[model samples]
Target chain A: MSEILERIWEYRQISRVELVELTGLTSGTITNLTHDLIQLGILRENEAISGNVGRRRVMLGFDPRFYRIIGLDIGRTSFEIIVMDLNGTILQSIEREMNGVQGPEAYFQVITPTLTTVKQEIEAAGEKILGLGVGIPGPIHYESGSLLAPPNFPGWKGYPLKQMLEQQFDLVTLIEDDARTSAMAERWYGLGKSVQNLVSITMGTGIGGGVVTNGKIVRGTNGLCGQVGHMTIVLDGKMCDCGNRGCWETVGSIPGILSRWSQGSTLMELQTAIRQGEPEALRCIDETLAYLEAALVNVQNLYDPELILLGGRLFPLLAEHLDQLKPRLQSRLYAFAKDRLRIEPATFGTSQSAVGAAALMLGFLLSEPVRLLSLQDS
Target chain B: MSEILERIWEYRQISRVELVELTGLTSGTITNLTHDLIQLGILRENEAISGNVGRRRVMLGFDPRFYRIIGLDIGRTSFEIIVMDLNGTILQSIEREMNGVQGPEAYFQVITPTLTTVKQEIEAAGEKILGLGVGIPGPIHYESGSLLAPPNFPGWKGYPLKQMLEQQFDLVTLIEDDARTSAMAERWYGLGKSVQNLVSITMGTGIGGGVVTNGKIVRGTNGLCGQVGHMTIVLDGKMCDCGNRGCWETVGSIPGILSRWSQGSTLMELQTAIRQGEPEALRCIDETLAYLEAALVNVQNLYDPELILLGGRLFPLLAEHLDQLKPRLQSRLYAFAKDRLRIEPATFGTSQSAVGAAALMLGFLLSEPVRLLSLQDS
Candidate 1:
C-alpha cells in the first residue's frame, strides 16, 4: 500500500495499471490499496480524456490540499520558513535576514510568531498541517533531535529543537542537518530526482555535504556521516576553527574563497569582483575551484555517487565557471576507467534549504504512510 | 524466512525462542520456516542438555557439511585459495607464491591445478560445492565479474575472470575486488560481525577500502565505491602513476612508507630497523602514519562508519604502534563531540582475503535463499 502511494507521489498522476507495472503488485492489490487510499482522502483520482473520441482513463494523484508540511531552514546568516503541500508545492514561503539572531532564546522569539502566522494563515483555509520539519546547521543528534554545537551557531548546543517545536505546534517535528535536508530535498524535488545514489555538497560560509544511497539518506552511526567539509584537504596548510589544519571548508567554502582575497569581504562583493574579471578575484576563485574539484573527486572516489551536486550560496557564483571547473575535476580522476560523474548545480537556489527541510516531512510521509495515517488519526 | 536464516547465521547458534524475539516473526511462522529449512538440509537442530541435563532443548545451527564454498584471493605477490563450509570453517587451505606469475594465463596455470586438487578432495567427502568466490586485486566490473587494470597486476585489464572460472569449474562464480571481499568476510565471520556500518581499509602494496552500510556492501553506481586509495591526500605533493598527484596509496600505503626511507627495503627489513629504534626507519613510519592518520580521519568524516577495520599486511605491523597512532587521529576529529571510533586490526590476518571471498558467496546465499532453491532445482 505504501509502495502504491510512493509511486503515486513520485509520478504525481499515475494510473492503477502504471502502479501495477511499477510495483510488480497484482492488479487486484493495486485496486484495493488505491480504493482504500482514495476513501481515506490521502489520494484522489481524476478522469482524463484522451484523443477527440474522449476515451477516459482514471489517474491517481496525492490530495495536496488535504495535508501540508512546514519547513524551517535555520542558517547562520538568515532563516527561511515555507509551507508546502503534500506534493512539495510551496504554498507560502518567507525568507528573513538573521544576521543578528543570537541564541536559542532569540531564535525562539523570532520563529514563534512566524510559526503562529503561517499556521493561522493556513488554518484560515481549513487545511491540515501534518507536521513541521526543520533544517539546522551542524551535527544533529538525530535520535533526540537536538542540535550539537555547530561551530558557526555559537549558543545552540544541546538544544532540543524538535521537542520545543513539537510542544509549541502540537504536531510531529523532524529536524535534520541543513546539508542532509538539502540533499533529501534535491533527491525528491530538484536536480537529483532521478538519481538514487548521489552526494550533495553545500559550499557556503562553510562546506557541508549529504549523501543518498540506495534511495535513502546515508545517516551514519552518529548522524555525522556527511561532514565532508572537515575532511583534511591540505596537510598543515591552514588552521581551521574546528581545531584542524587544512580542512576542506577552510579552502573550499565561500569564506574560504573570500579568504583568498580579503577575509572580511562579503560573498556579493567577491562575486562582483569576479564578474569584473579582477585577476586577484579570478585567482582566488580558481584556487577555491581547485579545492572544490579535489573534494568532489575525493567524494566520488569514496562514495562513487552518480551525481555530485553543488549547492548553497557559492554555487550560483560558480555556475558560470563550472565549465572551467569540470575539466580540472575530471583530469584528477582514476585513469583506467571512463569517468561516470554527472556534476550539476542544484536546481533550487538559496530557498533550497527550506524546501529540503520540508522534504524531511515529505520523505517521512512518502516512506511511512502508515505513520502518516497514525498521525492523521492522532 | 531469509531473515530468520540470516539471524541464525549471524548468531551462529540460536534457540527458536531467540529467533522469535530477534525476528519479531510469529512463533508459527518461525516454526514453519525452520522446519522447511531443516528438511532442506539448510538448518540443523541439535539437542543440547543444560542445567540438570534432564530436559533437552533443540538449538538451531547451520549444517556445516551441507554446503561448501571455494574462496580465491589473487594478489600481487602471492595468492591463496580456501574451501570452507557455510560456517566459514576452512576445510582445506593453500597459499602459493607468485613471484614471476604474469598475466591471467600465468594466474590460471597456478590456480587451475590447485582448484582441481581441492575439488577432488572436497568431492571425495561426498559433499556439494555450492559456488566459487574469487577476490582479485583491482577495480572490477562487478556485473561482468571482470578485473580492471590494477597498478600492481599487469596484463589483467578487462579479463573475464568470472566467466573463465565458471566455464572451467562448472559451478556458479562470483568475483569482487579484493578489498570489498575482505570487508565482506570481516562483516560475516570476523571482527566486523557485530557492526553493520563499517569501512574496511586494506593497506598493503596499494590502499583500497570497502564500506558496509545498513548491513549490506555499498557497491556504488559503477561498483567503484571504496576506492579510497585513489583519493588525493596531498595537493600536488607527488605525481602518482594513476595520473593524479599525492593519492592516499602513493603517500600512505606500504610502498609509500618504504619510499620515505629506502624504496628497495622490504617491510621485514623496516620492521627490524623500527624494533632497533633506527631514526631513519622510525621517521619513515611516523611520517607515513601521519599521512595514514589524516586519511582515516577523512574516511571517518566522510563515511561515519561505526568501526574501521585495518586489513592487509601492514596493519598487523602497525598494530603495536596503534596506541601512538590513535591519539593523532582523535586530535583531528570534530571538537564538539567525543570521537567514537573503534579502529582495530582485522582478525583473520593474511588469509583474510580468501575468507572474505568465501563470504561473498555466503552473503549472496544468505540474502537470497529462494535463489538457492532455484539453483537446487537447476
Candidate 2:
C-alpha cells in the first residue's frame, strides 16, 4: 500500500493493473493495498480512460487533503515559502522581501515570526505541516547541521539552522545547497524523474550545479561536489569568490553576462534594448552562449549523464544559443558510440528551489522500505 | 570454518579461541564447521601455540594444495602468466614477449603455443588450474562477452574474448580491462581491502582510472565508466587516439613526459643523467609531476575516495610525486574526513592486473553463494 502511494506521490496517476505489473505482485495483493489506501482517505479512483483496452481502467491517485510539507527558500534579501501536499501539489504559497539579516539573533527574529505567520495562514486554510525543508544558496554541512559557505548571502556561515527550525516547529528539518535542492525538485517532480545520473545546471546570478549519481545526490567530502562553478574553465578568465581565477562561473554566470555586455551596455540597459530587439543585446546573449558551450562541453565529455536540465531565472535566453551548443557537443563525441543526450527546460521556473526542498523531505521521509533501509547504511 | 578460512586469507591464521571471538558462533558449531572443513581438505590445523591468550592454541588456515588459478596479463609487447593457489601464493610463473599480433585470431595464434606450454607446466608442478583469467588493455563488455575498444590491442574491438577462451579451455573464463583488473587486485589482495571508494590510477603511456564506489566498480551504461584517460584537461590541446583533443592522456602520458624532457635533452640521455641526479632530468620529472598533479587532483576532487593507488609501468618514475600530490588534495578536502585520503603505490606492480583478473574469475566462480548465484531474472 505504501509502495503504491509513494509511486503516486512521484507522478499524478497510475492504474491498478499497472501497479501490479510494476510491483510484480498478485492481483489480490494489489486490490487489498489499494482498498486500504482509499479507505485511509489518502487516495481516490478516477473513472476515466484515454485509451482502448480490454476494459476502461480507472486510475488511482492522491486525494490532496492527506498531508503537506513546508518548503522554505532562505535568501539574502528575499524569502519564498510554499505549502505543498504530499503529492507535490502546491496549494498556497507566499514570497516576501527582507531588508537584511545580520546574525543569529536577527535570523531568529526573522525566521520565528515568518514561520509562525505561515503556520497560522496554513491553519486558517485548514492544512497542517508534515515537515520543513529549507534551501539556502550555499554549501551546507549535512553532518554538523550548519551552513558552510554561502557566497551570495554573507553573515550566514555555520548557523544552526536545523536546531532553530526544530525548536519552533515539531517537524523534521533539512538544510541543503539550493542548487542540490532544486535538482531534487526536478528529479522527483520534473524532467529528472527518469534520470538516475543527472546534472542540474542552475545558471542565475551565481552559477552552480547539483550532481545526482546512483539515484542520490553526491555530497562531496566537504559538501562541495557540484562546485563546478568554481572549476577553472579558462586559464586566466576572471577573479572568483573562491580566490580562484578563470572559474566557469566567471564566464557563464549572470555577472559574466553583464561583464561581457558592459563594453556597450549593462543588463538593465540590455533588457530595455532586447525588448526592442537591439543588436547589442542580441550580441551579448550570443557571446554568453558561446562561452557556455565551451564549459558545457567539458562537463559533457566527463560525466555523460542522461539529461542536462537548464533552470533558474536565466534559462529563457538558452534557446538563443542551444542550437549552436548541440552540434559542438556532437562533433566531440565518439564515432560509432550512441550518445543518449537530452536537454530540457525546468518546469518549475524560479520556484524550483522551494519545491525541490519540499521534494527532498518527501523523498527522505516517504521513500519505500527497501530504499529507506539502504539510505541509512549509505 | 569458512569464516576461519576467510580470516586466514586476511591475517594468515587465528586460534580456535580467537575464531570463537570473531565469528560469535557457539563453540560446538565452530567445532563442527572446523572439523567439516578439515575433512573436506580445505583447511588444516597447525599444532602450535604462537597466538594464545592463556592456554595453548591450534592455528587453522587454508590448505594451500586445495586449488590454484592461472592468471595472464597480456600487454602490447609482452605477457606475464602465473599459477597461484587460492591463498594468493604463486607456484610457477612465466614471462615472454611477442612483438606483433595482427588481429584477435592472429593474436591467439601467437600465444597458443605458450598457453599449451603453461598448462603442462601447471599440472607437472602439481598445481591444478581451477580457472583462467586474462587482463588486456581494453574496454571489456561483460554482458556481450567481448572486448570493446582495447586501447593497445588494435583491430580487437567487439571480439568475443571470454567465449573464445572458454571454448578452448572448458574452464570458467573472465576478461577485464588491465587498469580495472589491477584495481580489483588492489582492492582484494593489496591496499584497498578495507577501503571503499578508492581509485587505482594507472599511469604509463596513458593515464586511466578505475573508480570503486560503494564497494562496486561503477561500469557506466556502456561498460565505459572510468575513461579518466580521455577526460579533457586542456581545452583545445593535443589530440588523443580516441579522436578527442585536450585529453588528460595528451599531457600526462609517458610520451608526453618524454617529449617534455626532449625539449631540453633526449629522453635516453636524460634517463642516464637521472641515474647521476642531473638537474635537467630532475626538472623534466618535475614537469611530469605537474601534469600528473592536474589529473590526480581533479580525480580526487571528483570522487573523494579513501585512497588513490598509482600503478602501471610508469609509476616507478612517478612515485615521488605523491608527496606533492597529497598536500594539494588534502588542502581541498574536509578536515573531519579521517583516513579518507592517501596515495599508495601498487604493491602488486605489473603483476596486479593479471592477479586481479584471476581474482575476478574467482569472485564469480568461487563457493560464495552470492557471487556464484545465477543472474537469471526471478
Candidate 3:
C-alpha cells in the first residue's frame, strides 16, 4: 500500500496504470489501496488527462486541501512558523524575534496566540490540520517530546513543549532537534532528495549537524547525535560555555569569529570587510576556515556521507568561498575520503528550519503510514 | 526462519516446545523447520534432557563441526589467522610478523601457503570449510574485496584481494576493514554485547575506529567511516604522513608518545615508567591522555554511542588509567553527554581482529539465513 502511495507521491500526477508499473503491485491491489486512501482523504483524484484517445485517464495526487501541517522552529534567538500542505508546499510562513522571551511561560504567551491565529487561517482555507512539528535546539527527548537542557537556553530543560502544544492546538505533534529536522528537510525537499547517506550542517551562532544513513535520520542514543559544534577541534585551546575547551564552535562560529576581532562586529560587518579584502577580517575568516576544515574532515571521516550540506548564518558567506575551502578541506582528509567527500551550500537557505520542521511531520507520516491511520482515528 | 536460527544460536540448547514458545511459531512449523535444518546439517539434536517424570526431551543445537570459517587479520606490521567453528570458538590459530613485507604480491606469497596449511589442518580434523574472512587495514571496497591505497602500504592500491582469495580457496570470502572487524568482535562477544550503538577505537602504531549502530557496523560511504585517528586535534601542531597537520595519531598513538621522549623507548618501557611514577614518563603519558581526551570527546559528540571501547596496543595501558581519565574526559563533553557516555576496554584483547573476522562470516550468515541456502547450492 505504501509502495503505491510513494509512487503517486513521486510522480505527482501519476495515473493508476503508471502507479501499478512503478509499484509492481497488482492492478487490483493498487485500485483497492488507492480507493481506501482516497476515502481517508489522504489521496485525491485529479482532473482527466486528455490524450488523443477515446477515453481520458484520471490522475492521482496528494490531496493538498485534505491535510495541513504547521512547522515551528524555535532557536536560540528567533522562532519561525510555517503552514504547509501535505505535499510540503508552504501555504504561509512568519518569522519573529525572540530577544525578550525569557522563560517557558513567556514563550508560551508569545506562541499560543500566534498558533491560534495560524490555525484559524489554515481552517479558513478549508484544509484539515494533521499535526504540528516543532524543531528545537539542543538535546530533545524525541519519544517524550520534551526539550532537554540546552546550554544556550537555560530555562527549556525538561519542558513538555509537545504536550502543551498538542493540548492547545488539539492536534498530534512531533518534536525533533533542529539539526535533525534540517537534515530531514534536505532529504525530503532539497539537495538530499536522491542521496541516501549525507550530513546536513548548520553553521550559525554555533555549528550543529545531523546524519542520514540508509535513508533514515539517525537521532543517536539520547537524541544528542548531531552536536557537531561541541566536537573538540583544539586540544585545551580555549574555554567553552559547555565547560569544554577548544570546541569547534569556539573558533568557527559567528561569535567565535568575531571574538578574534574586538568582539563588537556584526556578521554583516565581517562579511563586508572580508569582501573588501580587509587584512584583519581576512585573517580571522582564514582562521575560522582552518577550524572549519578540521571539523569537516572529522565529520567526513566519521560519517563518510555522499554530500555535506552547509547552512545557517555563515552559509552565504562561506558558500561564496566554498571553492577555495573545498580543496583545503579535502586536503585534511584521508586519501580515500578525499575522492568521495563533497561540500555544498544548503538549498533551502533561511527557510530550512521551517521546511525541515514540516518535513519531520511528513517524514513521520511517510515512514509509518500505519501510524498515520491510527492518528486519523483521533 | 532466521528468527529460529537466531534463537538456537542465542540459547545454545533448546527443546522443540521451548523453540515454539520463543519464536512464536506454530508447533507444526517448528517441527518441520527443525527437521529440515537438521537434515541440512546446520542443526543437531543433542542428548535427551533427563526428567524425573514424563517422557524425556531431545534438545536442538548448532552442529559445531558442520562448518568452519577461516578468520584472517592483515595489519600494518603483522597478521593473524584463526580457524573457528560456528560458535566462534577458535579451533586453530597462527600469528606471523610482516617483517618488512611490502606490496600485494609479497603479502600474498606469505599468506597463501599459511592459509593452505591451516586449511589442511582443518580438513584433517574433518570440519567442512564454509568461507574465508579477511580483515585488512585501510579503505576496502567491501563489495569487490579490493584494497585501496593505504598510506602505510603504498603499493597495494586497487588490489582485488577478495577475488584472489575466493578463487584460490574456492570458498566465499568476506573482506572488511581491520578496525571495523575488531568492532564486530566487540559487538558479538565483548563490551558491546548488549550495547547496540558503539564506537570502537584502536590506538596502536596509528589510530583507527569502527562504528556499530543498531547492532550493525556502519562502513560509511566509502568504507572509511571510522578514521577517528586522522581527525585533526591540533590546528597546526605536527605534520602527519597522511598530509594532514596535527592528526590525533600524531600526538595520541604509541609511536607519538614515544617520540615525545628519546624516540627509541618501547610502549612497555613507557608503561613501566608511568606505573613507577617516573616524572618524565608521567608527563609524556599525561600529554598523550590529553590528546586521547579530546579525540574521545569528539567521537562521543558525533556518534553518541552508548559505549566507547578502547582497543589495540594502548588498550591495556589506557584501561588501567580509565579511572583517572574518565572524569577529565567527561568534563570535556556537554553535560547531557556526560551523563550517558561510558568508556570501557575492549574485552577480546589480542584475539579481537581474528575473532571479529570470524564474526563477519557468522554475522552475514545470521543476518540473512536465506543466503546460506544459496551457498549450499554452490
Model number with the top lDDT: 1
Q: B106, model 2: CA deviation in Å?
A: 3.8
All candidates: CA RMSD in angstroms? 2.0, 5.5, 2.8
User: lDDT tens digits, residues B233-346, model 1?
Assistant: 898778776656788999888878888886347888898888998889889888888788888878888888989989788886788789998887777776644367789887
* Model 3: colliding residue pairs: none
- Best by DockQ, which number? 1
TM-score of each: 0.96, 0.81, 0.93
Worst 10 residues of 2 chain A by lDDT: A369-378
lDDT, model 2, position B362 = 53
Q: State interface RMSD in Å for all models.
A: 1.8, 3.4, 1.6
TM-score comparison, 1 vs 2, better candidate: 1
lDDT of 1 by residue, A142-203 (tens): 77889877877878989998888888988888899999998988998886777889898888
Off by over 4 Å in 1: A26-28, A50-54, A335-338, B24-28, B50-54, B335-339
How much is A232 displaced in model 3, in angstroms? Answer: 0.8
lDDT of 3 by residue, A1-378 (tens): 667765665677888888878878899988888898898888899877476774677899988877888899988788899988887789899888888677778877888889899999878977687788888886887677888777668689999988988788888788888888899899887877778888999988878898998778997888777688988887777898777888888888888889987634788888888888888888988888878887887888778899899999888777777888888877767676686777777877877888899988888777677787788558
lDDT of candidate 3 over B218-315, digit per residue (tens) = 98788878888888888887988776788888888887889987623888888888888888888888888888888888888889899998889777
TM-score sort, best first: 1, 3, 2
